[model samples]
Target: MTETPFKISIPDEKIALLRQKLELTTFPDELEDSGWEYGVPLSDVQRLVARWANGYDWKKHESQLNSELPQFTRDIDAEGHGTLSIHYVHKKSEIAAALPLLFIHGWPGSFLEARKLLPLVTKGSDNFPAFHFVAMSIPGYGFSQSPRTKGFDLAQYAEVANKLMLALGYTEYVTQGGDWGFPITCRIAQIYGGKHSKAWHTNMPIGEAPKSTTEPSLTEKEKAGLERTSWFHRFGGGYLRQQSTQPQTLGYSLSDSPAGLLAWIYEKLVNWSDSYQWEDDEVLTWLSIYWFSRGGPTASLRIYFEAGNHSLGAAFSVPEPRPTIPLGLSQFPKDILVYPKNWTREMGNVVFDADHESGGHFAAYERPEYLADDLRKMFGKGGPAFGVVSGHSGYA
Candidate 1:
């Protein structure tokens, strides 16, 4: 691994240009019925744009981000294949005793996905100083060089992320992810189980979907959960279809305009945020991370071109289970798709499965206090850390 000479300083000119573009954005005329049907709600977006154009302060958010986290880039050259460049930030916490925790964000989510809640996960006052926080931007997202090719599925991402962790000199660490982060963490646990992979955790894991054959009998509560899951896929999967088939076209629209990018992302923010009334300060704080990194477009579309290509239909196999390593599952209520405890039990040791009373798909973002504390307990117990655990198990 080579050190990539890089910094998180976004030039003043770029910030000014972004604001200018936001100010100049012209909304396309749409019928009342057409509002938000095609994408983000026109009226809601206008409100957000108005605030972004006139009230959002990028420099303030910039200063806060720089002070809270130190950002840098590293290049990992895989044997003879090539080098992959990544951007990462480590929160400056005084607790050297904190367990090493690696956080991975999902599609349309930059490293800043944890921005509002980093302190909750790493600081002392909330509960405990439990983790040495390491946050990273996925390739082609934010400062990290976007993947030059397609097929950057969870397995591929896990490979690169593990390399990145090794490059950072963390022999053992605990990993937590949501959305794409969940699948990526799963691959790491599967491929690098035991001493090399250690223990890992996830919030929104994509486990094997229920088979379509004759209805396997489900308990009453299980049946309710399945019904809810089915409803979400039927109603909300339109976005997935577009993401899988025509990401390039979607990329063109999102990448071209600051307003377009903000609306595209803000939908998830508002919908998934535990706090439904997303304040201006909170909303722009996140948008600024993308705007400064100019990651809004590249990261959003990468998932479409990368994971959409394959792995969606691959048969679900218990990721080469490692008996020695422990796995933690922190399931949140509002998550659209969830893996039952029985499903995760097949892959590895289930140390902890806590179904929280609150929060949604973005657990870390929505309930960092709960997420971080749970992770702290898992790490402090010393069962396993990261995807790599101690000792050779069959999984590794």
Candidate 2:
């Protein structure tokens, strides 16, 4: 398979249609007392919709994306499962000089989420080191094509990620991830770490696998993580359940109305991220990606549905033996929850674990410098130090 070259440019018709949809949206009437219980406040949606219809500029975002990062497409051979095209953005750095680090994003996020790290990782920031960065959208999430089969779970994601490395000619590299990215990275290390696989790392690792019969013993932190997970199942799980069962019904509203899509995606940004202050430009930039592709609903829900059905037998059957590969973690206060270092020590060789005073789930987007510095110390030549970045380059 050969590399595919393309650029992002939204067509005039799509923009016009989006404007029409924004103008003619049949808004839902809300009760004064409902507040945020019925999802994003109707008032907030109206404000965002008005701005999206009149003020947001697709051209500006397109220009910024083209200028800041180089986007490319290549067909990654998914083991024996034929070939699939994947989209990726690599900072313009020397191949040999930069450290090859792949950043995988989580649910409700695309490759665009990882774009913030270009500056800090490529050019050492005040708190971090310079390393070559590569960010890819998960399959069915952004520009990447959806899996041909029904169940493209985390393990398959890891397998396909390895193929992506080979397709791009990466021998071994470090990885950084949170949420779904963390689990995917864990699977990568488990399968390919030490002798068999390449060295890898993850920040937010999952220690407690969902038990079917007996509840597993829980630490205080694990208990909190479980609560967060349960809370998600209670409140936010509707989206997951809908996606897993009948995604088509919801897709219609999201795919047809730009306002609907914006509300759906933007609400998550407001709640999940700690950097709402940094949201104005970033939010619109991400919306442009989904708006242009008309992939708002299909891609958004498909990943959740895929994860819901993913078989865990393979993941648990072969546990990861403690590998000597250096692992690092950054625990943030506002983050839903994270495992204790002792839990992670059972999986791989953990060298660094720091409890950050601030930041949240979207640390890379919200607190790039903090996360970057930790990454620099872990992967770069710089040893443990307060906010010192190493000068490294080249992403294989």
Candidate 3:
């Protein structure tokens, strides 16, 4: 597979056209005192849309991303999907013995989620292990080419990830991800573990628990988690229903109107976090990555439809084989579905688990330092997954 250096350079015409779309955009009416109870407030979208069309400097942010991120493109041939030109952020650590770690992102998010953790993970330290980080723009997201044919499911996603690592000469490596990333890497651990996949970790480790008759009682924390899960099923799960069954139909609105797309993703960005302050510029930057992505924002939504095994009206869950690799979880209180710890343990051979008082769905984005530290401890000396990658011990 041939790999090439990649850069983020949106053409002048595309930038101009985005402004045109934003200028001609229309917004929806809002209920008074809505304040996130009724989706994203109209005022937030308006202010962001106006700034997105005006003061927010795409070129400035574009250049900063280009400079800060070391990105590349490579043709990864999935067994049946043919050759796919994949885009990825590849930052090799200064430590020669650093372990290779793949970072994956889910819906409404791109490889940009790994930006903050990049420096922290790759930084050489006296006490902790460093990582050679590789975060791919999962096929249909960011600058990567989306799958041309239908039925490109989790297995295919795992295939692309494993091939990318093998192409980079990492015969064995570990992984970290959340959201759609959670399942994709779990499939990797199931398929490639014991040999190539070594060990894996997630900030969003969720699973179907054992039958009550065979399971232990729930803790107060676990009961609280169930409450959060119920809340999600009521308020935050509409997008899943639509995305799983008819992403193509919904894609039209997201594709045509900048306002529609902004409100759609902006809600999750706010609701998913535990009161994390989101600057308008930061919001726009996150939105811009989708808006300015190669496959368009709509393409990213297809994963929700493709990655699942559920039929319409059935519960939105994709059941997979239990992964046997060493699993480490950094559970956060505000994550979308805070599954009881027992459920996640039933899903894999869990070695380490840590819970935080703060943070949520976007753990890497919302709390980078904490996630980095958890990863360090998990892969550090005497940690459960230490030396899983053979010679690369992540030390000086």
Clashes of each: 15, 6, 0
What digit string (tens of lDDT, one per residue) describes model 1 on residues 1-396? 665544466777877888788889999766778754566678877887888878877777777777766777888654333676778877645655555567888766778777755776666533333456778787667777666655666667777788877777666666788777766777777776664566778776445644657645655655555665685677656667676667777777776687887887787776554555667677776766666654456555656555635334331234444435677877775676755556545556777777776777777767777887777556544433322333211110
Q: Model 2, residue 155: displacement in angstroms?
A: 3.4
Which candidate model has the greater lDDT, 2 or 3? 3
Give me the overall lDDT of model 2.
0.66
TM-score of each: 0.83, 0.83, 0.96
Q: Which candidate's TM-score is highest?
A: 3
Clashes of 3: 0
Q: Tens digit of lDDT per residue, candidate 2, span 79-159? A: 545567787776645434566677888766777767777677777544444566778776666677767766666667888
For model 3, residues 153-177, the per-residue Cα lDDT tens digits are 8889999999999999899999999
Report lDDT (CA) for all predictions.
0.66, 0.66, 0.88
The candidate that wins on lDDT is: 3
